[model samples]
Structure formats: structure tokens, C-alpha cells
Target: MYKVKVFVTLRESVIDPQGTVAKDSLHKLNYGEVSDVRIGKYIELTLEKTDRNIDEIVKEMCEKLLVNLNVEDYRFEIEEVVAQ
Candidate 1:
């Protein structure tokens, strides 16, 4: 089996309103040292062994469904795992 960790984030050119809000709130709460905050999504997926290329599969999934190509960028890490 394989464990996949997908990280999706807004492109640097895109403004992250939610992250900005969180940072502002933190500053208001006296966390003055925080310079900036960026929010992102983490996704975990488990797949059974397959003949298909794992990297290609993951990239296809991310591009087709998991991420918005226009505004968001994504990267993934794959780890081999033993099924219980």
C-alpha cells in the first residue's frame, strides 16, 4: 500500500484572505512577532499497489480534482505502507 500526503496552497501571486484574517486576529491577540500567515489544505490518501506510475496518478488526481490549477498549487509525498 501507499500513503500519500498532498499539500495544496494558494499561489504566491494569489491573495489569501483567510490567512490574512487569521494573522490579523493573532496580532490583535498580542502575537506581534508573526509576520504573515498562509493557509493551505492537507489531504491524505491510501492506495493499493498498482502497475500505474504513482507519481503520474497523484499528479493527475491533483490536477483533475484535488487542486484548482488557476489559483492553487499542490505537491505530494508518497510513502510505502503495510496494510493492516
Candidate 2:
């Protein structure tokens, strides 16, 4: 088995409205030093051993479903599961 950790975030050129809203709210709550905030998604997936390369599998998943490539960027880390 393997564990996959995926992170998805808006592209640098894209505007993050949710992040902006959160930042504004923080300032209202006395967090004035918090100038900026960016929001992203973290995903965890477990997969059974497969013949395909883990890297390829993860990339495909991210590109096809986990991210909107036009506006978001994604990264993933994969590790083999060790049974106790």
C-alpha cells in the first residue's frame, strides 16, 4: 500500500477571494499583522500496490480531477506503507 498527500493551491497569478476574505476577517479580529492569506486544499489518499509508477498515478489523478490546471497548481508526495 501507499500513501499520497496532495496539495492544491491557486496559481500565483490568480486572485484568491476566499483567502482575501479570511485575511480581512483576521484584521477585524485584531490580527492586523496578517497582511495576506492563501487558502489551499490538502488531500490524502491510500492506494494498494500497483504495477504503475506511483508518481505517474498521482500526477494523472491530480491533473484529471484534483485540480483545475488553468487556475490552480498541485503537488504531491507518495510513500510506501509499512505494516507494523
- TM-scores of the models, in the order given: 0.96, 0.95
Pairs that collide in candidate 2 are none
Model 1 clashing residue pairs (backbone) = none
> Candidate 2 at residue 8, lDDT?
95
Clashes of 2: 0
Residue 39 lDDT (model 2):
99
Regions of candidate 1 where Cα sits further than 4 Å from its true position: none
Clashes of 1: 0
Which tens-of-lDDT digit does each residue in 1-84 have in candidate 1?
Answer: 999999999999999999999999999999999999999999999999999999999999999999999999999999999867
Error of 1 at 83 (Å): 3.4
TM-score of 1: 0.96
Candidate 2: which stretches are off by over 4 Å? none
RMSD to the hidden true structure, all candidates: 0.8, 0.8
lDDT of 1 at 72: 99
lDDT of each: 0.97, 0.94
